[model samples]
Target: MTPTIRGFEHHRVPVDGDVSLHVAVGGSGSPIVLLHGFPQTHLMWRHVAADLAAGHTVICPDLRGYGASDKPAEAGPGTYSKRTMAADVVALARALGHERFALAGHDRGALVALRAALDHPAAVGHLACLDVLPTLDMWDVMHGVDAAVGFHLYLMAQPPGLPERMIAASADAFFGHFLDRWAADPAAIPADVRSAYLRACAAAVPSIVADYRASAGIDVEHDRADRTAGNRLRMPVTVVQQDWGAALGFDAASIWRAWAPDLRHTLTGHGHFMAEEAPAMIAEELRALLTR
Candidate 1:
């Protein structure tokens, strides 16, 4: 039977000046902040969060510029940087009365989680990243055949005004293409959920493009500076991903090891949206990570 995620209470809390997040909170125990990836919202964690809430308090938030969160126009380089997004997570957790909490992020949220660990090592007690590599390695690994796997990366990585304009022109087709192509089982996401995602992305075009553009520019500089400073994720880290790196001629674990000393890496058969495609397995992996 498909699970139900109806009881959780939704909230809109201020993070930084003029920016707030629509968050869902449920269960009660040690805190675990669940960060959703791009083209998705906190609803991505519905199944997983419901399970984890049995033994933990789960806080799932819509990242800025996505879902019901504030979609303010980009205010400068600092506004959409992962560093700033990470700080928003910190503030959200603190606002919820969690001084330190375990954090897990999928896709784009994984990037934010990495930044959170580096920027606020004392706050994120345990870290889990699903289906992504460090930004620098990600850029270095994309070429030739593997390049096709992340067409959106290049598309959204384009300089400012142009990409945003093009994407806005064909919003549904651009976003729907990823929805159809990436899912191992399209039926897994019901039409309502899919429509919700499309509408959210469509409405947040400028901010969404700016977020990706920042990754191609300032986010890369942030990652390179961290590497130069020898900054690493201080918490125990668990990574679950499909073997994209091996298929693309890069050692995924080795790349992650450079950033996280205590790491557990697993290759799953699920597609890019592992949390939704294989929630039970993802939940088990998360449970084990928390225990360790």
Candidate 2:
């Protein structure tokens, strides 16, 4: 069953080559696209989207290989690159008559938002990232002991076949691990929502792993290239994350500042799933971003 998202109107919109994203659109006014992270679908934005919809046209979509969206076969490298996913979002917004829009993303989705803002500077009005770092910084911050905290990163970073097979063998338990640990309060994600996430992730193991695979490989290359080219998000960017850098022995703000000049760097105690755990707070942060 498709989990309902209150007042959202669902659509299967074409993005590119036989790929049509399952998008949930609501409200009116300036458009704001919301992208969900790993192990969850567009449903992750239920509260945030609904709240934002009161004053913005909220566009929520199950990213390329997630949720009810089309999961194309893992054809090759860069297939699930954030660049392609970002392009898919740009197209989705343009299709909805939004030449430019505010964008916010969490976890994996934040990576997409980062890439979108960097790649399509003019098309993104504001960019908000929740609980994540750029791909290169993510790898840099995970040295030695701290790497253990992101064991999934190493697992998915492995070359193809093994990661897919291993994750498949224990999909629920593996996916459920984050759904359990990443949230400050597990109850933030209702039981039904958790079940739906596990089910969707388990069923799309290949595509899901591919999404992570791209991150470990091509995404890092892209980030590196952007750094070499002195490219950064030219729009207003807000980053809200738990101060994991202090724990990981890395400088989060400095790293983010290098990429976002006009940046609102927030160090939140909220968990990784902040959008779900604290919708009102997330909505408020987004409002601040839009107003900037």
Candidate 3:
């Protein structure tokens, strides 16, 4: 028999005077915050969170400007930075009575997790980054045809009004294109989940584009500052990624080592959406990371 989904409780936690997040929390035990990436919602972690919740409390939040979260029209200096988003995660955890927790994030979420680990080292006990590189290295390594892999990065990185306007004009096509291209098996994403994600993206087009735009601008500055200051993720770090470096002629582990000294890097054959495509493997990785 399929187990009943205990479902999730909606939460509105203030991150700043004018900003707050729409979070979903369920289960009970040691807290484990699962953050979703771009073109998806916290619902992406439904399978993994349900499994983890058996032994741990799971907190899943739609990052600012995505899903059910507030989408502020203004993208101020601190508004969309990963650093600020990380702080939102910390605030959400604290509001939920978890001063410290194990944190894991995929794609864009991984970037926020990394920033959280750096910004609030005392709050994140363990860190797991799935399928991303540090922002600067990601930009530094891309070139010519190889850069085509992340074409959206360049498109969304463009200055202000244009990118958002274009994306907003054809939001479903813009968001669905990545959803279709990145998944190894589209069937892994259920119909409802797909529709939900597309709807969220359509509704949060400006903020979504702003989030990526920051990655190309302020986020890069933050990563550079961290590197220059010799500040690395000061926690046990587990990274699961496809061998993008091998395809593009670079050392993936070496790149990760620059940011995470206590690192366990695994190259999986899984596509970008490892959580959905390979739940068992993703769970196994998370279990080992949390245990270690």
Please provide, for model 1 over 1-292, each residue's C-alpha lDDT reduced to its tens digit, 9 standing for 90 to 100. 2223566888999999999999999999999999998888888898899999999999999898888899888878778899999999999999999999999999989999999999999999999999999888899998997688788888888877888989999999998888888788787778878888888889988988878888888999999999999998888999999898667888999999999999999988788888888899999998999888
Instruction: List pairs with backbone clashes in candidate 1.
Output: none
- Model 2 agreement with the true structure over 1-292: per-residue lDDT tens digits: 6576789999999999899999999999999999999889999999988898899899999999888899998898777999999999999999989999999999999999999999999999899999899999998888888679899888887887999999899999999999998889898999899999998899888888888889999999999999999998889999999999788888788999999999999888888889888999999999999999
Name the top lDDT candidate.
Answer: 2
The order of the candidates by TM-score, greatest first, is: 2, 1, 3
Q: Write the per-residue lDDT of candidate 3 for residues 61-150, one digit (tens) a residue.
A: 989989888888745756799998999999989988999999999999999999999999999999999999989999988987977979
Q: Per-residue lDDT for 14 in model 1?
A: 100
Question: What is the lDDT for 189 in model 1?
Answer: 78
lDDT of each: 0.89, 0.91, 0.88
lDDT ranking from best candidate downward:
2, 1, 3
Error of 1 at 118 (Å): 0.8
Could you estimate the TM-score for every candidate?
0.97, 0.98, 0.96
**In model 1, where do residues sit more than 4 Å from their true spots?**
1-4
| Candidate 1 weakest lDDT stretch, 10 residues | 1-10
Compare the candidates by TM-score and give the number of the best one.
Answer: 2
Candidate 3 clashes: the total is 0
